[model samples]
Target: MDRLIEAIEDKQNPSVVGLDPTPALVPVQVMDAYHIEADEYVEDDDDNLAATGAAAAYFEYNRAIIDAVADIVPAVKPQIAMYEALGPAGVDCYTMTCQYAREQGLYVIGDVKRGDIGSTAAAYAKHLSGFDGADVWHEDAITINPYLGSDGIEPFTAAAGETDRDLFILVRTSNPSSAQIQELELADGARVYEHVADLVEQWGADTIGRFGYARTGAVVGATHPEEGAALRARMPHTFFLVPGYGAQGGTAQSVAGMFDRDGSGAIVNSSRGIIGAWRDDPRYSETLEAQTALDLVAANARAAAEDMRDQLRVALA
Candidate 1:
């Protein structure tokens, strides 16, 4: 938690670029550039070649985004599901992306959202605590699912403590369907998310860092401004990983309350808005060379990240 806080303070930006790239988000020229190599590797397997090519393009795209915004933003949230969609090749791309982001000195937040109990949970915790002393994942923090209760979360917290990493538990998420479970009222007259928030605070009680935030943070979506603000008061020791910004319709004004008085405590994330910025650029053309297209991606991403930071600065002020 301290490390992350320091990075955010250093950059003076509480925003995290989400490296959740999909096929549609990537430039067609970039994807096409890898088809020949993918074909060579897959050798007659069309499906494998397509996946391999997509995975390759995604890594290049991620690299461009990381290189563009590494200095402007403190962290990056790479949604694992986006990589997993392409199977093993995509998983490799995800790890490569994390490694690349970290190499550029940006904190990598693996948006895995994993949940399970006992051994399975411990295995997932390995993302923070690398197996055999190798830090394969290269993530500084990760998102977790709390539906499985303490058993599901304890392993991650323990790993975080041991590794000096952090975890953000799902609380009030950004997606509309999240309310189906998180907003349900319990017998004690508290919403499910509120109860979960208390547990998240408790989970990190012993791990509070110099900045007054615990390693166990909460995932409070930026979309719910009122609730997010209230949670800031309720979970005093808990930091926040706020999502649902940009492409999901969350703005700086919508998420301003999630931060503490000093404009700390939360890091907002924007996926498509930053990485897909090139799509809206009139200069983009499908016929452009891959490197040229990627150059546009890098330029657009940097501009978008800068715009987001400026917007947040105004809102927080």
Candidate 2:
């Protein structure tokens, strides 16, 4: 977490691009370049050409975007669900993407959101912690589901402690239906997410890093500014991973309070808005060849990230 914050401070940018790619979002050239052919992938359960092609395409696309934006942004978040849906081929792509990003000097946060209990929790923590054999998907930080409470989160904390990694426990997710659980009130009148926020502070206390913030952080949706501001005051020591910007309708103005008075302690994520920028960029030329088309996408991603960084600065001011 300290390292992540340092990266943010060094770049003076609190934005992270989410490398969550869908088939439609990736370029056709990428799919054609690395896709596992239909005949080569044998499992009917996971062997669809589209799925495999999408994974390969995403990896190629991720590499291009990372190449373009790595210098300005501090990190890249790869939502695991996007890769897991495609099966082993997708998993391989995810691993490859992480490795490539790390090589490019960018932090990788695996949005696994795994939750369980006891040994099960331990196993989930172990896997998500990047202990799987021949690991290539090692992450500098990860997101975990906090619904199962302390039992499910303790293993991850313990794992992080040993690995010197960081964890962002989901407190208030971005989806509209998240209120069903996160907004519930206890007998004490505290909202469910508030209680979770308090626990997150406690969990992160022992791991307080050099920046006066903890390695354990919270995922607070940027869509709810009042609650986000409230959480900001409540968990001063816990960093935040703010999502729901751009495509999710979260504005920089709404997320401003997620940061501290100095404009530190949080990172706003923009996925499709950054990766899919080529769709709207006037610089894109349909007449270009495959490699040039990929370069245009890369340039578009870089431009979008720079634009978001400036917007965030304005909102913070």
Candidate 3:
């Protein structure tokens, strides 16, 4: 948590770029360029060739974005599901992306959202701890699911302490359907998320860093401005990993209150809005060469990240 906070302070940007890529988000030209390599390596395995090629393309797309925004943003969050969809090849791509982001001096947050109990939870904690002393996953932090209770979360907290990493527990999410569970009213009149917020604060109580935030942070959606504001006040010690900006309709103003009075305490995330910015550029053409399209992708991503940073500065101001 201290490391992440310091990185954020150094950049003067309380924002993170989400490195979530999909076939639709990546340029077809770039995808086509990797087919030959995939075909050569995955020969005779018709079932795996397409997925392998797509995964390769996704990595290149991610690398372009990371190289573009590594200096402007403090962190890069690669949602695992995007890579996991491509099967084993995609998982490898996900780890490679994390390693690359870390190499570029950016904090890598694995948006894994893993949850379980006991030893199973311990296995998931390996994302932070690594295997046999080797940093396999290369994540500085990860998102966790807390529905399974303390047993599901304690292992991660322990691993974070041992590895000097951090975790953000899902409390209030950005998706529309999140309300179906997160907003449920308990008998005590507090919504489920509020209770989760309280627990999150407690979970990190023993692990507060130099910035007065816990190693265990909370995932609060940027879409619910009022709720986000209230959560800021309610969970003073819990830092926030806020999603739903840009493509998800979360404006800077909508998320401003999630920050502390000093403009700290939260890091907002933008995925498609940054990585997929090339799609909205009129100059981008499908007929362009693969490297040319990638160059365009990098330029658009950098511009979008810069714009997002400026918007946050103004909103916080």
**Cα lDDT tens digits for candidate 2, 1-317:** 88899889888999999999887676666566556554366456653677676776777788899999999999999988889989887888887888899888888888888888767889877654555454545688889887778888888888888777889999999999999988998999999999999999998889999888998999998889889999999999999999999999999999998899999989999999999898887766556555776888899999999999999999998
Model 1, span 1-317: residue lDDT tens: 99999999999999999998898999988988887778777756476888899999999999988988998999999999999999999999999999999999999999999999877999999999999999989999999999889988889999999999999999999998989999999999999999999999998899999999999999999889999999999999999999999989899999999999999999999999999999999999999999999999999999999999999999999
Residue 126 lDDT, candidate 2, scale 0-100: 65
**TM agreement with the true structure for every prediction:** 0.98, 0.93, 0.99
Ranking by TM-score: 3, 1, 2
Kindly report the root-mean-square deviation of model 2 from the true structure over all alpha carbons.
2.5
Q: Using lDDT as the measure, what is the rank order of every candidate, best first? A: 3, 1, 2
Please provide, for model 3 over 1-317, each residue's C-alpha lDDT reduced to its tens digit, 9 standing for 90 to 100. Answer: 89999999999999999999999999999998897789887757588888899999999999999999988899999999999999999999999999999999999999999999778999999999999999999999999999998888999999999999999999999999999999999999999999999999988999999889989999999989999999999999999999999988999999999999999999999999999999999999999999999999999999999999999999998
RMSD (Cα, Å) of model 1: 1.0
Better of 1 and 2 by TM-score: 1
Q: Give the backbone clash total of model 2.
A: 0
Model 1 regions lying over 4 Å from their true place:
43-46
**RMSD of each candidate relative to the true structure:** 1.0, 2.5, 0.8
lDDT score of residue 44 within candidate 3: 76
